[model samples]
Target: MAKIRLADALVKILEKEGTKFVFGHPGEQILPFYQALQNSSIKHILTRHEQGAAHAADGYARSSFQPGVCVASAGPGALNLVMGVATAYKDSIPLLVITGDVSSQLKGENVFQDVDINAVFEPITLQSHLVKEPQEGIQLLKMTILTLKTGKTGPIHLNIPRDVLQMEVDQSLLDETVELNLPNDWSNLKPAEKLVENSKKPLILAGAGVLWAHAVDDLHVLAEKHRIPVATTYPARGVLSEDHPLSLGLLGQRGTKAANFAGKNSDLVLAMGCRLSERTLKGLGDVPIIQVNLDEKVLKGSVNIQADVKKFLEKIRKTPPKNTDKWLEQLSKHPKTHKIRTNFKKTPLKPQRAIKEILEGKDDSILVNDAGSHTTWVNLLIKALESPSLIFSGGLGPMGYGVPASVGVSLARPDKKVVVVVGDGGFQMTLQELATITELDLPIVICLINNRSLGIIRQWQELYYGAPFQVELDNPDFVKLANAYHMQAKRVDSPDDILSAVKDALKLNKPVLIEVIVDENEDIPLPE
Candidate 1:
C-alpha cells in the first residue's frame, strides 16, 4: 500500500464528502495542509480576514444547503473565526470548520499562537475535538458530516496539529473511511399526524430547519394543500413564497402583525425545523404545538417529534384541509402586515423607500442582510418570491456578515445576482471584502444605507431611555471608498433617485455600490 501525508489524506476525505470549496486565511502552521491542497480539485478562497472566510463559508452553507467548509490557523486565526462560527451555530447552519494547531508536543505549553481551540469553540459548535492521528481524523471527518446531517445541524470544529498533518499514513488505511451511512431515519410522527388531522385553524411555523432539510417545496405543498397559513421564522423567510395568500411572513420580534395575530389566535401550531424560541413566540399564548426538529434537546412543543422536516411534511401533506372560513375571515382583517410602501416620498431617502427602489424590477436575487435598523426594513418591506433565497445572521446579530456572505453566495449560486443590504455601521465592519468581490468580478449589488448613526441603538435610546448618545456615526465618504477599490460607486442623496439608480446598477451585472443618504427618522417604524 502506498503512503500519503495525513493532510493529503484529509483533503481526499473532504472530497469524498462532496466538499467542493474551502474558504480560509492561511498562516504558517497550516502551510502543510495548504500545500497538500495543491494537488486536489478543492477550490480555496483567500479572504482578507479570518472572520470574512468564516462568514463566506456560512453564506455558502446557507445558500447551498450543503456543509460549508472554512479553515483557520490556531490561536488568533482560529479566534477571529469565532464570530462567524457562533453566528452560524445560532442559526443552525451546517459548517465544517478546520483550524491548524501547534505540534501536539507544544499544545499545552504557551507555544506561539496556541490556545485551547476546542475549549473555545465547544460552546458554539455541536462538537469540538482535536485530531490525534490520521486515522482518527478520517473517522472524525466522517462523524462530523454525519452529525451535521443527522441531528441538530450546526458547525463542527477540528483542530489539527502541524506535525500530525504531516505524519505519513498507510494508503490502505484510507479504505477504512470509504463508506459512509446515516442511521435509520428516526421520527415519531403518529401523534403529530393525528394532531394535524384534527386541527381546524392550524398554522405552520417554518424555521431554518426547513431549509436545512431541503424541504421548502414539501412545506409549500403542505401549507397550500391544507390551506394552513405559514409563518416563517426570521431565517426561514423564503420557505414559503411571501406572495402566497396563506403566507403570514416572519413571526415574533421583527414579525409581521398578521403573523403575530395568527400565532395568538391559531387553534394549533405546527412548528417544523425551528424551535419555538422566545423571539419567535412573543405574543403567542398557550397553544398546542406539534414540533418536528432534528435536535431532540430543543423539542419543547406539546407534541415533540424528532424527525426530518421534509419527511415529516411529506407524511403530513396527505392530511386534507379543514373548513376554516372563520379563521380566514379573522386573518383577512390583519392583511395590512406585509404591504411594501411603494410610494414613500421622504427626503434623505426613507430606508423603506430605498429597499423598495433597490428591489424594483428585481427577479428573485439572493438577498444578503447586515444587522441594524436597515435589517428590520429589509425584512419588513421586501417580499420573497417563488423559491426565495435569503441569508442573514438570525441567532447572533453580527454587523459585518452581509459583504463577505455575498461573496460566498455569489460563488455558490453563480446564476443568481446577489443584492446585499447593509447599513453604514455594518458595512464598515467587513468593508475590506469589497476587494474580494471585485477580484472575482461577482455580479453583486451593494445597497449601502448610509445613515450616519447606529440607527437601531439610537431608536432604542430615544424610545426607552429618553436620551440618544454614542449611537451617531462619523462616516467616511463611502462613494470614494468604493472608487478606491476600483469598483462602480454611486451616491443617491435623493429618495426618488434610488429607484432609477438601483435599477441601473442591477442591470450592470457587476460589483457596484449605491450609498443612499438617510437620517435616523427614516428607520423602520416600531416593529409590529
Candidate 2:
C-alpha cells in the first residue's frame, strides 16, 4: 500500500481501466495530472482546443464501444466541452470527462479559473462527482468506470481540486474493484415474441443504443429471421447493411425515402434501443410501437421490454422466423429510394456525386461526417455495413466535429482506415486538429467538400427570405492549410478529378485531405 500522489493514482486508475489515450489540452491547473501521465502507459492526445478534445473522445467512444476519456481545466476549458459532451449524452455515447478545479478551500470564492464544474455538467451526464480528497476521488473514479461499463451508458464527469490531485493517497486503494449489481429477466422476450408473431407488417427501428450495445449482429439476426424491414435512426444508419434487402435505412429529417415510406405504413414498429422521439418517429402516424431498451424512461410503447437490446434480440432469435412477404411486396411496389442527382460529368462538383464516388464500392469503410447539408447527402448515400460505420453527431449536431472525430476514430480503429466526409462550413470548425492527424501519421482520408456557403441555411434563406447573410465563407486555401500542418493535401474541382484524387489519397497510406470544390448553389431540397 505505497503512498503516491492522488494525481499519480488517478493516472494508474485510468491504466487499470484499459484507457489507451486521453484527449485534452493542457492548462496550468491540470498540469499535476498531466505530469502524472508522463511515466504512464496511457497516451495523452493534445487537441488544439478543449472542444476538439471532447469531440475526438466522442468519436473514440462511438467506434470502440468503450468509454472515451477527455480532460480539461476548470472554468472556460471545462465549459468548452459542453457541446461535445451534450452530443455524446444525447446520442448515448459513453464518455468520461475529467476537469481540474480550484482547490477545496477556494470553492465559491471565485478563485482563478474556478467554476462549479459538477453543477454545470449534471444535466448532461449520467452522474457528476466532485472530489474533495485523493482517496475519495480514486473511489469515485472506480465506481464511475463501473457505471460506464454497465447499463444505460452516457457522459459522466469528475471534478478534482488542484490540491486534492497532488495530495498523497494509499496506492492499495487503486486495487479495489467496484462490483456490479446487474439484474436480468428473460420473461419480457415471451411477450415481445408474441407481438412479433401477431403482427404481419412489422418494422424494426434501431437507434444509437444498438451501437452502444454492440448488438448489430443480434439486430440483423432478428430482422433477417422475421423478414422485418429494418430502419435505423440517422446515427445508427449502419446497424444493418444499407444494401440488404431488409434494410430501409434511416428515418428522420435526414431520413431515406424508403425508410420514411416504410415507417409510415408499418402496422407494428419494433423500436429497438431507440427513444421514439419526435424526429425518429417522423411520418409514422399512430403506429403501435414495441420499445426495447435498458432505460425504462424511454419504454413508452404499447409493448415495453426493459432489457439490453442485444439480449432481447438474442432471446427472440431463438424463436421461429416469421414471414411478411405479402407486406414487403406491397411496400416494395412503391418508390422507396431517394431521388438523388447523379451527374458525375458536371464540374463545380455535386456533393452527392463526390460522396458516391468516394464510397460507392467500399461497403466496409468506417465513415464519419459532420453536421451540415453534407450530413443529409452522407446519410442518403452511405451504405453502412454495420453499426458505427456511419458515425456522426445526430442529436446535438455540431459543426467541426468531423476533423477531430477522425483523430479519435483513427486511434481506436488502427486496422480500418477512417473516411471523413465534411463540408467547408463544418470542416473549418475543427481544421486546427490537422496537426494532430499529421503528427500521429494516422490513416485518415479527409474528403473536404468545399462549397462557399452554409448550404442548408443558405438554401432556406434564398427560398424563404430571398436573402443570404452570414452564410458565405471567404475561406483560406485548404490545400496550403493542410500542407502547413505537414500533411499531404489535394484540390480537385471536376467530378472526373474526384476519382483520381480519392485514389491518390487512399494510396498515400498516411493522413491526407482532398478539398473537393462542390457546387455552391446546389439548391438542395428538403427531400423525403
Candidate 3:
C-alpha cells in the first residue's frame, strides 16, 4: 500500500469538514503543501496578494456560511495574511489559515525566509499552532477547524514546516480525523422564553452570528411571533429583508432614530450574536440585556445564554406568547423620514447624494464598504435591498478588502449586483484589483468617495489630534485609473449626477468606477 504524507492527511481532514475551496498565494516554504494539494479535490484560487487571499476567504466564508480557507508561505507571505486573519478574528468569521513556516530544526535560528509564523498570528488568532511533525499536522488542522466553528467562530492559524509536509505518514493516521461536537445546552431556553414572553417592549438585535448559525428565517419567525422589532449590526446587513415589518434596518449611532429609541426603551434586549460594540450600543444606560452567543465570554454581561442562536430560537418558538399585536404596532409606527439632507459643502455634488442615487432603488444589491471616514455615509444610509447582501471586513477594518472582496463576492453569487464603496485612501490599498474585476467580467460598481485625505484620520485630527500631518493625500484620477484597467469610468461632481451615474453603471452590467469628490473637512458626528 502507498504510504500517505502528512500534507495529504491534512487535506483529507479539511475535505471531511466540507471545505471545497482555498484562497492562497504560492511561495517557496509552502511548495510541499501545494504539491500535496495537487491530487486533492479542493480547488485553489491563486490571489495577487496574501491579503487578497485572506479577504477572498473571508468573503467566501461569509457568502457560503462555511469556514473560509487561506494559505500563505513563510516570511512576507505569512506577514501579509495577518491583517486578514485579524479581520476574520474581529468579525467572528470562521477561517482556517494554513501557513508554511521554516523547518522545526532551523526554527528560531534566523534562516532564509524564516520568521515565526505561529508567533506572528498569536495576537490575532483564537488558537494557533506550529506543527513540528507531519503527524502533528493532522491533529492541529482538525482541531483548528473545530475551534473556529465553536465558541465565537473566528480565525485559526496552523503553521506547517516544510519538512513536516514532506514527511511520510501511515494510513492509520487518517483515523485521527475527528470532528469536535458542539455542546447542546437547552438549559437556558425556559428562562429566555419567559423573558421574551413577559416583556412589554421586546427587541431583537441580530448580528453576523445569526447568519453564521443559519438562523435568519428562524429568528425572523420568532420576532414576528413575539412582535419583536428587529435591528441588525452593520455586518449583518441582510439577515432579514429590510422591507419586512419587523426589520428596523440598522441599529445604533447611524441607525434610524426609531431603531435607536426602540433599543433604548426595550425591556428585553435579545442581543443574539451581536458584540454590543460602541457602534451598536447607542449609549447603554443600564438596559436589561439578554445575550445569546456561542462565545461564553459574551455571556458574562446582563443575562447570559450560552448557546447557538438557532437552538435558543427553536425553544422560544415552542412557547412564544400568543399576543404581540400591541408591541408590533408600536414598532411599526416608528416613523420613516427623508428630511435630513447633509450640507457638507456648497458643491452641488454631495457624496451622500451620489451614494443615494447610485444605490437608490434596487434593494437586492450587495455593498462592499471599505473603511475610512468617507464610508460613514454608507453606514448611516445604506439600506437592505430585495436580495441578500454581504458587508465585509468590519472587524479588521482594513482599507484594501473592498475591491478584492467584491471580486470574491461576485464570484460566489454571480447574479446579484455587487457594489463596492471605498474612500480614496482605502481604494489605493488594492486599486490594482480593478484588473481582477475587469478580467472576471463581474458587474461590480466601484463607487470611490474621493475626499483627498485620509478621512478617518482627519476626523480624528479635528476631534482629537488637533493637528493633521500626513493625513492629506494627492489622489490619482480614478476615472483614468478605471480606463487604464479597461473598465468604464465616470466622475461625478454634482449630487444630481449620482443617480444617473449609478443607473448607467448598473445598466452596463460590467465593471465601472464612479468617483465622487467630496469636501475633505466634512465630519460625520456620532450620536451621543
Candidate 4:
C-alpha cells in the first residue's frame, strides 16, 4: 500500500467530507498542514488574527449550515481561538477546530509554542482529542467531523503534534468513515399536542434549533395551521418573516412589546428548540412550558420532547389541533410598542434610526450583528424580511464577532447582499479584517455605529454602578480607515441621511463602510 503524510491524508478526508474552505493563520508548528493544503482543492483564507479566523469559521458554519474548519498553531494562537470556540459552543454552531501541538517527545518539557491546548478547550468543546499516532489521528478526525454534524451540534477540538502530522500513514488506513445515529422518538409528542389543544392561548417560542434543523418551512406551517403566533429568539429571527401576521417578532430582553406581551399572556408556551434563557422568558411567570429540543440535557418544561425538531413539527403539522383563531385575534389586538422612530431628525444620528434605514427594504440581505448595546437596537428595530437571516451571538455575545463574521457570510453566500452592524468598540477589535474584505472584494456593507465607548457596559455602569467609567473608547476615523483599505466609505451623522447612505452603500460593487455617529448617552428603550 502506498504511504502518504498524515497531514496530506487529513486534507483528503476534509475534501471527502465536502470542505471547501479552511480559515486560519498558519505558523511554524502547522507548516506541514499548510504545505499539504497547497496541493488540495480546498481554499485557505488567511485572517488578520487567530481570533478572526475562528470567528470567520463560526460565521461560515452559521450561514452555510456546515461544519466550519479552522486551524491555528500552539500556545497563543490556540488561546486566541478560545473566545470564538466558546461563542460557537454556546450557540451550538458546528466547528472543527484543529490546532498544532509540540512534538510528543518534548511534551511538558516547555517546547516552543506548546501549551495544553486540549485542557483549555475541553469545557467548551463537544469532544477534545490529542492525536498520539497517525492511524488514530485519522480515525479521531473522522469521528470529530461526525460529532460536529450530529445531535445538538457544537465545536470539537483536535490537537495534533507536529511530528504526528509529518508521519507516514498507509493510504488505506485513512478510508474509514464515522456514522451518526440520531433519535426520532415521537412517543411524548401526544401530550404536547393535547396541551396545545386544550389551552385558550398558546404561543410558539422558536429558537436557533429551528434554523439549525432546516425546519423553517415546517415551523411556519405548524404556526399557521394552528393559528399560533410565533415569537422567535434572536438567533431564530428569520425562521418566519417578521411581516407575517402570525409572527410576534423577537421575544425577551430588547424584544418587541407585542411579542413579550403575547408570551406573558399565553396559557401554554410551546418552546421549541429554545433554552428559555432569562432574557427570553422575562416577565413571563409560571406559564405551562412545553419544551422540545434535540438534546435531552437542555430540555426543561412541564412536558419535554427529545427529537429532531423538523420531524416533530412535521408530525404535529399532520394533526394540528383546532380552535386557535380566538387566540390569534386576541394577540392581534395587542399594540406594538417596538416601533423605531425613523422620523427623528437629529444630529449624531440615533442608532435605531440607522438600523431602521439600513434594513428598510433589504429584506433579502443578511444582517450579521456584533454584541453590544447597538445590537439591542438592531434586535428591537430591524425587521428581517423575505428570506433574510439575522446572525447574532446569543449565549456568548462576543464583541469582535461582527466584521469577520460578515466576511465569512459574504464568502458563504456571495449571491446575497451581506450587511454588518457593529459598534465602534466591537468593530475596532477585528477591524484589521478590512484588508481581507478588500482583498476578496466581497460586496459587504458595514454599518459602523460609532458611539465612542463600550456602549452596553457603559449602560450597565450608569444604571447600576452610578456612573459610566472606564467604558469610553478612543476610536479611529472609520471612513478614513475604510478608504485606507481601498474600499468606498462614508460617515452619516444625520438621521434623515441614513437611508440614503445605506442605499449608496448597496450600489457599490465592492465592500463599503458607513460610519454612523450617534450619541454615547443614548439608551436603548426597554419594552413597556
Candidate 5:
C-alpha cells in the first residue's frame, strides 16, 4: 500500500463513508486538511462562522438521516462549535466534528491557537479523541462512525494535531472497512405489545426517534391499523400528516389544545421514540405510560422497552385493528378551537395572522423555525404534512439556528421547497449566512418576523416580573439588508399582504426574503 499524508487518507476515508459535503472555515493549523480537500470530490461549504458550520451540519443531518461532518481550527474556532455541538447532542443528531490542534511536541506550551479540545467536549459528545499519532487516526474515525450509527446517536469529536495531520500514513490502513454489530434484545417489547393490545382507549405519543429510526411509514401503519389517535412532541410534529384523522397534533406547553385534552384523558399512553420531557408531561395527570426507546436512561414510564423503534413497531403491528370509534368520536367532538383573525386590517401585522397566511395550503413545504416566542406561534399554528417537515431547536432552543439551518436544508433537498421563519432578534444571530445563501444561489424563502424585541422574554417579564429588561432590540431594515446580500426582498406590514408576498417569494428562482413587521405587544396565546 502506498503512503499518503494523514489528511489525504482522512479525506479518502470520508469519501468511502458516503460524505458529499464538508462544512467549515479554514485556518492556519487546518491548512493541511484544506489542501487535501482541493483534489477531493467532496464539496466544502465555507460558512461565515464556525457555529454556523456546526448548525448547518445539524440541519443537514436531521433532514438527510446521515452523519454530518464539520471542521474548525484550534482554540476559539473550535470553542464556537460547542453550542452547536451541544444542540445536536441534546437532540440526538449524529454529527462528526474534526478540529485541528497544536502539534504533539507543543503540548501545554501555550502555542498559538492551542487548547485541550477533548477535555472541553467531554460532556457534549458521545466520544472524544485527541490523535497525536498518525496511525491511530483512521481507527479512531472508524470507532466514531460505528458509535454514531449505533443506539442513541449523538455528536463525536476528533482533535488532530497539526503535525499529525501532515504526517504520512499507509494507505491500506485508511482503506480498512469497519462493520457495526449491535445486539438486538427485544425481550421487553412483548410486554409493551401486550399492554397496547389490552388497552381500549390507548394513545400513541410519537417523538423524534420516529424520524431517527426512519419508521414514519411503520408508525402510520401501526396507528391506522390499531385506530389509535397520535399525539407527537414538537420535534416529531410531522410524523403523520396534521390533517390525518388519527393526528391529535403536538402535546406540550406550546402544544395544540385538542392534543393536550386527548393526552390527559387517555388510559394508556404508548410513547415511542421520545424522552417524554417535562414540557410534554406538564399537565397530564398520572396516566400509565409504556415507553419504547433505544436508551433506557431517558425512559420515564410505567414500562420501558429498550429497543429500536422501527423493529418494535413492526412486531406490534401483528395485533388486528381495534374498534375505538366511540372513544375517537368522543374526543373528536371536543376539539379545542381558538379564534384567530387571519385577515387583520392593522398596519403592524399580528404574528398568528402572518403564520396562518404563510402556511395556507402549503402543507407540503418544509419549515425551519428559530427559537423565541415566534417558535411557539409556528409550533401551535403551522401543520406539517410529512415526517421531518418541521425542524426546530428542540432541547437547546438556540436563537440563531434558523437561517444557517435553512441553508443546509436547501443543500440537502434541493428539489423540495424550504422556508425559514425567524424573529427579528433571532434573525440577527446568524444573518451573515445570507451571503452563503446568495453565493450558492439556493432557492430558500426566508420569512423574517420583525417584532423589535425578544417576545418570549418580554412575555415572561410581563406576566410575572411586571417589567421588561434587556428584551428590546435595535434592528436594521431587513429589506435593505437582503438587498445588500444581492437577494430579492419585500416588506409586508399588513396581514392582507402576507399570503401574496410569501407566494411571490416562493415563485422566485433564487433566494428571497420577506420582512413581516409584527406587533411587539401582541402576545402568543396560552393553553387553557
Candidate 6:
C-alpha cells in the first residue's frame, strides 16, 4: 500500500502495455516525466522538433504495428506537433501523445507557455483529455491507449500539468479497471461473402488503415486466394511489398500507371481500410465501390457494400472471385510511367534522376519527403525496401516534414538505412536540427533537391496563374552548413556525376547531406 507519484503510475501503465520507447522533446514543463524515466524501463528518444516526435512515433507504429508514444512541452511544442497530429488523424495512424502543461493554478491566466492545447487539437484527434488530478493520470493513460484500438484509429492526447506529476497516488487506485471499447466482431462476413461471390474483376485497394489494422498478412492471403491484383494508397506504401507479383504498386494521382488503370477499369473495387480520396478516385463516375472501414460513415457514398476489413476478408475466404486472368492481363499491359525522363545535360542535374540514383544505391532505405516538387519525384520514383518503410506528412504535406520525420524514422529503425529527400525551401524550416542529428548520433542520409524555387506552387502557377511569380529561393551552402554541425556532406550538380557521388554517400554511413542543384524551369510531367 505504498504511495506512488502520478508520473510513476503513468510510466508503469505504458511499460505494462509493452511501450518500448517514447519519442519526445524535453523542456522545463516536462522535466518531471524525464526525471521519472530514470527509474522506469521505458526508453526516451529526444527529437529535434515536436513534429518529428509525432512522425517518429507514427513511423514506428506503422512499421511495428504498435501504439507510438510522443510527448511535448506546452505551447509552441504542442503547436509544432499539430501538423503531424492532423496527418495521423487523416491517415488513421494510432498514436498516444502525452503533453506537459503549465500548472493548474495558472490555468486561463494567459500564463507563459500556455496556449490551449485542447482547443488547437480538438478537430484533429479521436480523444483529448486534460489531467487535473493525480489519480486521473493512470486512468487517462489506459483510456488513451485503448482508444487506438477503436474504430477509425487516430491520435489521442493527454494534457498533463506540472503539479500532477509530483502528486502522491494511492496504490488501490491502480486496481481501477478502464474499459477498452475496441471492435472484436470483425469476424462476421455474410455481407462480404455475398459481395465477393457476385463480383467479377474485383480489385483490392489497401491503405494506411491496413497497417493500423495489422491485417496485411490477412490481406495478402485473401488476395492470393482470389487472384486479386492488389493496389495500395500513397500512405500505405509498403503494406504489400512492391516486389509481390500481386501488388500493382501504389494507386492514386502520383501512383503507378498499372494501379490507376487497373483500379479505374475494374468492375468492382474492394477498397479495404481506405478512404477513397480524390487522389485514388482520379475521376469517379459510378465505379461500384466496396468500402470496408471501421468508420461506418465512410461507407455512405458510391459504396455498394461495407464491413470491417478483417471480417470482410475472412468472410470472402469461402466465396471465391471469378477468374480475372483476362482482366489482370489487361492491367499488366498498362504502360509503366514510373520512370522520369528529363533533359539535364547542359544545366543543373535532373532532380528526378538524382532521386532515382539514390533509390538504386539504397534500395532498403527509409525515404521521407518534404512539401515541394521533389515530393512529386520521390513519390513517383523512390522504391521502398521491405524493412524500414516509406514516410511523409501526406495529409498536411508540411514543409519541414522531411528533416524531422527522418530523425524519428532513424531513431525508431536505427538498424536500417534512413534517407530524407527534401527541397531547399522545406529544409530551412527545421535545418537547425542538423545539430540534433549529430548529438543523437543518428546516421540519416539527406538529399536536398535544391531547385531554388517553390516548386509545387510553381506547378500550380503554371497550370492556373499563367506564369510563376515570387517562387524563387536563394539557397545556402548546404555542405558548409552540414560541416558546421560536424556531419559529412556533398553536392552534386552535374547529371553525369550524380550516380557516382551518390554511391560515395551510401558508403559514408554517417549523417550526410547531398544538395543536388536543378534548373528552375524543369517541370514534372503530368499524364496526357
Per-residue CA lDDT of model 5 for 73-155, tens digit only, reads 98898998998899998888899999998888996788887787899999999888899788888888887877676667889
Decide which is better by TM-score, 2 or 5.
5
For every model shown, the clashing-pair count is: 0, 0, 6, 0, 0, 0
Clashes of 1: 0
For model 3, residues 174-219, the per-residue Cα lDDT tens digits are 7765677666566766677777667787778888888888888898
How does residue 365 of candidate 5 score in lDDT?
66
lDDT of every model, 2 decimals? 0.84, 0.83, 0.78, 0.84, 0.85, 0.77
Tell me the lDDT of model 5 at 349. Answer: 78
Per-residue lDDT value at 235 in model 1: 84
* Model 5 ranges with Cα > 4 A deviation: 181-183, 320-322, 336-339, 361-363
Candidate achieving higher TM-score, 1 or 3: 1
Residue range 196-226, candidate 4, lDDT tens digits = 7778788889988887777889998888777
Off by over 4 Å in 1: 177-188, 339-342
Q: List the residue pairs that clash in candidate 4.
A: none
Q: Write the per-residue lDDT of candidate 1 for residues 485-508, one digit (tens) a residue.
A: 989999987777877877788789
Candidate 3 residue spans exceeding 4 A from truth: 12-18, 39-41, 146-151, 175-177, 283-285, 336-339, 342-348, 361-363, 386-390, 465-467
Lowest summed lDDT window (length 10), candidate 2: 180-189
Residue 240 local lDDT, model 2: 82
lDDT at 101, model 5: 84
Can you give the TM-score per candidate against the true fold?
A: 0.95, 0.94, 0.91, 0.95, 0.95, 0.93
Model 1: how far residue 147 lies from native, Å: 2.7
- Summarize candidate 6's per-residue lDDT along 136-231 as a digit string, tens digits: 888888777776864568898888898888788887777778886544444335555555677777878887777766677889898888889888
